[model samples]
Target chain A: MVRKRQILVIGNNTNGCTPKHEKIAYDIGSEIAKSDSVLISGGLGGVMEASSHGAHDANGFTVGIIPQDDASFANEFCDVVIPTGMGLTRDYLNALSADGVIIVGGGSGTLSEACASYMHKKPMVAIKNLGSSVDPYIDGYIDHRKNIKIIGVDTAQEAVKKILELITA
Target chain B: MVRKRQILVIGNNTNGCTPKHEKIAYDIGSEIAKSDSVLISGGLGGVMEASSHGAHDANGFTVGIIPQDDASFANEFCDVVIPTGMGLTRDYLNALSADGVIIVGGGSGTLSEACASYMHKKPMVAIKNLGSSVDPYIDGYIDHRKNIKIIGVDTAQEAVKKILELITA
Candidate 1:
């Protein structure tokens, strides 16, 4: 049996982001479902919840890798909740488990996850967000390694499209 | 019930470290076992193995948080092996699960664990070593946060003692 491809979406939590960001995340999740890939996320609020909600609504498989020990801590939409009990370090776990990654209107935690994914050689793409923590790496590489540039996208469709293509290639 | 205190030791795998470093790590694990604290590490070779070996010989509990998906990857001395399957990012899981952290001779992976632990506000200390990657933070905090000082100790005994005291107090 072929293991399902898991695409991770990392971003701001319930706070510090705009409604537009949530919509994009939701769309990304929908796109992931349509492509027949599994949706994976931090399994908290904000973008994580929004994406999972979108996927759930679309009958897509969704997995939430949460930092807390309690499985119930996962957002209601997560079909599979893996409570890491590792606090914020769970960020790396999500990045590690995914074939590719995406960022949407994130702060410090998002940047850390993005950076960790790059360090581990995971391909990534980001939705363009003004003043977002990930702005520096949008359409560019995180550092000198330049292993795989963090591609920037204008729409949720393109974000998933680019990541799938990048990882498959 | 008072939970067992889990003390983590992070450091180089099997390479780039001296035998003297391994001896110190082993002694530190022995001290942790003697104090009835559970020992934790990356669960691979070098310092991780030596420390687990010391703790196991002392009949102490040892938990190895390994990076691979397979539990068999852990060093034999580990009593409990948590196969994270998150690759190098599993470094953060070790730091997050520990009440305190001790750094033996290490490289970039160790530094990442140390930094993540500090970010999550875990007390930490290091065995003083000349020109180790952790030398810069030996007597200071990782960054300006100075949330809790990363104490430096001369011997394994001191390292364990200082970290225990810092975490409890």
Candidate 2:
């Protein structure tokens, strides 16, 4: 039996996220559900919550890697909760669990996830103008040789499409 | 038997680290060894390497929480290697294992560690002028109530002293 694709969605946990960022995250979650892909996130508020809500609304399986040992940190939409008790370090677990990573607006936490994804050699797609603080570091590719590239997209649909292609290819 | 204090040293893991950062990390490691405290780090290069070397030179017990599954990712000075295979996510393990955290110059990775330490409610002491990228976020205390504070010191000696006070208190 073929395994379902797991995509990790990374973003900020604060209320500072704009309406557009939340909408994009929600759309990405819906697309992932429609495609029968498993959605994974940090399981906190803001973008993570929005995406999980979308996935749950679409009847998609959602996993949240929570930093605390309690399930209370998880959003309302999470189907499965993995309490890591690793604090923000749980970001690594979220990235490593996914076949591909989709980043929305984020801060240092999201940037750490991006770095971890790059180090783990996971394909990543970043939605443009998402208020991601790691923009300077994500210079298309991670290295001078330009072998590893963080694919950029303009919209949620494009980001999901790119993630599908990367996962399949 | 009383448990030996565990001191986590966080810093830049790249060649871009300045000479002064290296010296402070080395000093912090030496102090940790002299105090019979176990030293821990990410077990990579730059400041991590320097601090590990200092601890090893002092014959201190040093542990490296490696992000990769391979033991080779650990620095030469690491006496004990915990290969987590979790990539940068292993930073949480490093922070959680320590009685206190001493931060040297760092970037996003170190900033993630700082955030984790705050969330875990661990006492942290940062060496001043360490080129820490999380300066803006480190508003002394992490929360609105200003209960948790990250003590800032101007020198390695001061950092060690502060760490000892925090851990023992």
Candidate 3:
């Protein structure tokens, strides 16, 4: 039997996120997990930790792909810890390994991963007003937005709705 | 005449070095600026802010490729702020545009950028004991290290020395 691929949450560690983003990510993550979608993240702090926590609380499997060798650094919520001795490339692998990518609040690092996702033709979802540098793809530019699927939602429920629709559809 | 390229420091958002990393990144940034190297960062707080402050104090150009559109989110030291509107992907460009990459105290985000530099085949320098990762690469996993050249040094002087040596040699 073929194992189902997981959903990669390409989150940002920028200034950390507000309570709103945390709530949104948590809600969406929980919903996604209830649907039996496996969650993966950078396994540190910020959205990765938040999403993992949400998934874990929902009794779903979570994977934290850490750049360091020590599993001690893995997110407290991760059930499976894959320690990559390769440093930051672990994030790249996280993006590449995902069947689809969802970007929560982010900074330059989030944008880089999005670019990689775009370059690799991966489906992407952006939580609106999350304050990402790539906000323009959804907000400002319409033509460029069509090149890649940029799904924007106001609520976490809607966010998960769109994500599930895109993935399962 | 070809314009000289700048040195971009891309690494973890967390100050893995704590109070010491702030001072170290500041010192190295100042030195690099004095030697006419422009400093670039992910444009968030912590090391990004510290190094930008150092370059600014030296009256050198400091560029912050921020993930957000608002220039106010950037540190006060930034002279050139590229509002990437791309989030973490902006950090990837910051690494791509650099002649070389310097890693200070970093976490997963920093590791991601370092890996990008490696994939892009850029020369890199790491502040010894500053990174939780890179130990394996420096020890003997030259094959795992790939096309990028990795050098480890204790002092800012040594980092500069090794970078110059790699460049000149």
Candidate 4:
């Protein structure tokens, strides 16, 4: 049996994200779902919510690595809520769990996730013009010596395509 | 009855930290223990290991928020190991569980913890010259308008003292 790909989506919680970011995240979610891949996120508001919403609309499975121990904090679109009382540190789990990561607009939290993804050596694709805190480091891998690279793309469709190619390659 | 103060120590895991960082972390741990406060860390290696060792020597309670689900991942100095199974996302719990935070030399993981502490409104103190990734944001709090501040000090003793004052105030 072929293993279903798990694509982790990292983004702003809500207050920091713009409507354009939300649309991109939603599209990314939909694309991942259409490809028969599972969508995973931090399971809160903003980008997480938007992406999960898109995936759910497409009848795709969505998992949320919630910081709280209870599933109550999970967004409405999350189908599988893994309540990890670990809090923001859960970004490591979010990154490690993914076959690939899709980054949207975010602040410090999103930046943390991006760093975690790089550290874990996961393939990452950042949607361009998100103005995320991870932007500063996106141009290069974690360091000159590391093989990990974060590909940049303009649209969600391109991000999905690139991520699929990366993971499959 | 007074609750025992919990001090969160943020630093790099073994692979990313230096001997100087380990020494400073050890001193901070010792100071925290002598002050009758519990030491908290991510519980992997490097600064976390050194600090936990110092706290153990001083007969202080040590808590490690382990990223893995198994307790075996926790360092020897950790008196209590909370197997978060949440990976790096556990940084949020490590920050929120503390009454205050002490930053030693750190990398991406430490940066995440510092950001989490700021977002949670926890008092923080960075040991100067530790070369932590949080240096960029240490001067100002997470928000310019917020009253929260991360005090910087030259010595471990001064850091402990300042943190106590901030928490007490």
Candidate 5:
């Protein structure tokens, strides 16, 4: 079987902002899974759990890039847990391995991972105003005045559609 | 002035989580700061922001290890931002530069960074339930547990005190 391209969901893992962000994050991840995309995450809680859960609920494949050998840290929804044995540096591999990236409401860690996606020239879509403590870091090139389609959308479905358009176009 | 020891806080950067987790994370960082500790992080969200803010609020310093050239991604609380321009690999340096590591609640990305900490033999403390989503992995340690301090604390204050007691002792 031809393997489906994995779309990594990079997000913030903050307790203060996660409860509200989880709703939209889950919607986007679920939409992506419903579209047959394999979900990948750092494999724990917050957006990772929501995204992993969304993909699993839709009967889609999910891969969690975990930091250690233990499976308990793997979010409950992850189908394949790959223990990186690398620690926080595993975040680098997560960003590097993805076909593209979707940045939901995020903070520094998400921003760092998103920068990785941008640096690797991977297609990226940042979901803005999802109730993160820190505002989304918008690339100047993708500003509203510009026609550059490093798309930004409010809903999950639209974000996925825009990502597909950018990738396939 | 005696320079504060830099304690690197490494872990997953998912969407913001709970205020309780943030409070715990900050409590640990603040405790470290009170001891003249300089906080370090991947320069982004979740525990990183919470910890950095805690240290900064305590009149301590913070350094953010950023993967991109732009320092805008650094949290507002960070006193200094070191742009690595090396994408996700920057996380490795964050792990390498720390005097020790305090893992707040995290996923795989945090796990990966934690692995780097372990590999380097840096003293590391996981805030029990609050640090990383290290589930089954936490249970598999048949040996070599002596080198790592796994403290199951209900609050960040205890976690910080434990980390200080271990590294300083």
Candidate 6:
């Protein structure tokens, strides 16, 4: 059986994010589904829920790695929820399990997962100039190692396409 | 039933560490086991293996969360092995699951886990003057957030005792 590619999307939670982030994440999630890849996220409210909602609506597989131990805490959109009971550390797992990552708009938590992706040599891309916390790291490396550049784009379609290309390349 | 305390040890792998680090980690592991707490680690090599070996020799429970998907990749010292198949991202899980953390000699991977622990508000302590990558954050906040401080200790016994106290307090 051919393994379906797994794509992870990281971003800000409800309070720290704007509505635009939600729309972008939703589109990215949908595009990932349309591209025949599984969608995964932190499984919480905000960008995570929005993306998962999009994927679930598009009839795509969705997985959520929640910080809480109770799977019920995951957004309703998650088809397969794994309650890690480990809190934010679970965020790193989302990055680790994915073939590539998309950063819509995020703060420290998303940056932490991004660091994990960089350390693991995973492909990643971000939506440009949304004034997101991840802006500094966009179009550049996360640190001095210069492991991989986080490609930047204008739309969710480009975001998903870029990640897939980077991964396949 | 009272839950047994879970302690996490993060540090350099075999290649980046010195023999002294191994000895220090082993002692820390033994001390934790003697304190009747479970020992947990990355389950790969160097500090992780030594700590698990110490705990196992002391007939204590040891859990190894391996970065690879193969359970066999874990050190034989591990009583329970979980292969995350998520690469370095699995390192964050070690901090999330533990009530407290101990830092020996470590690299960027360890620092990454340290960031997770801080975000989750997990208490941490490190060996002083070990020249590990985590030194900067020792006794200080990992970031401007300053959620928690990584205290400094001189010995394994002090490390174990301090963590138990911090958790109970």
TM-score of each: 0.59, 0.71, 0.53, 0.81, 0.52, 0.64
Task: Grade the docking of candidate 2.
Answer: incorrect
Candidate 3 CAPRI assessment class = incorrect
Per-residue lDDT for A54-79 in model 5, tens only?
Answer: 87877888899987878777988999
Ranking by TM-score: 4, 2, 6, 1, 3, 5
* Residue A26 Cα positional deviation in candidate 3, in Å, after optimal superposition: 32
Write candidate 6's Cα lDDT for B62-160 as tens digits: 999998999999988999999998777687678778999999977657777777788789999999877665665678765545688899999988999
Give the C-alpha miss distance for residue A151 in model 6, angstroms.
5.1
Which runs of model 6 end up more than 4 angstroms from their true locations? A1-6, A18-39, A50-93, A105-112, A115-120, A126-161, B1-4, B30-38, B52-93, B105-120, B127-147, B152-158
Task: Write candidate 5's Cα lDDT for B1-169 as tens digits.
Answer: 6766668876546463468667776776788788887888888887788888888888888899987889998888888999888766875788788777777776545654554555466666666655344332342320132335344555567666666776676
Calculate DockQ per candidate and list them.
Answer: 0.08, 0.19, 0.04, 0.28, 0.07, 0.17
Candidate 1 residue lDDT tens string, A70-130 = 9999999999999989788788788788899988877656766776787788889888854
lDDT of 3 by residue, B22-76 (tens): 8888887787788787788888887888888888888888888898988888888
The regions of model 3 sitting more than 4 angstroms off are A1-169, B14-17, B139-145
In the range A1-169, model 4's lDDT, one tens digit per residue, is: 7879999999888787788988999999999999999999999999999999999998899999988999999999999999988667677788888999999977777777777777678899898776676675675664433557788899999999999999999
Worst 10 residues of 3 chain A by lDDT: A138-147
TM-score of chain B of each: 0.96, 0.95, 0.88, 0.95, 0.85, 0.97
Estimate candidate 6's RMSD in Å: 5.6
**lDDT of each structure?**
0.83, 0.82, 0.70, 0.84, 0.69, 0.84
Docking quality band of candidate 4, CAPRI definitions = acceptable
lDDT measured at residue A144 in model 1 versus the true structure, 0 to 100 = 41
Better of 2 and 5 by DockQ: 2
Q: For model 6, what is the alpha-carbon lDDT of residue B26?
A: 93
On a 0 to 100 scale, what is the lDDT of residue A95 in model 1?
A: 79
What fraction of the native alpha-carbon contacts across the interface, defined at 8 angstroms, is recovered by model 1? 0.04
Better of 1 and 5 by DockQ: 1
Interface RMSD for all numbered candidates: 5.9, 5.0, 14.0, 3.3, 13.2, 4.2
B-chain TM-score, candidate 4: 0.95
Q: Can you tell me the CAPRI class of model 1?
A: incorrect
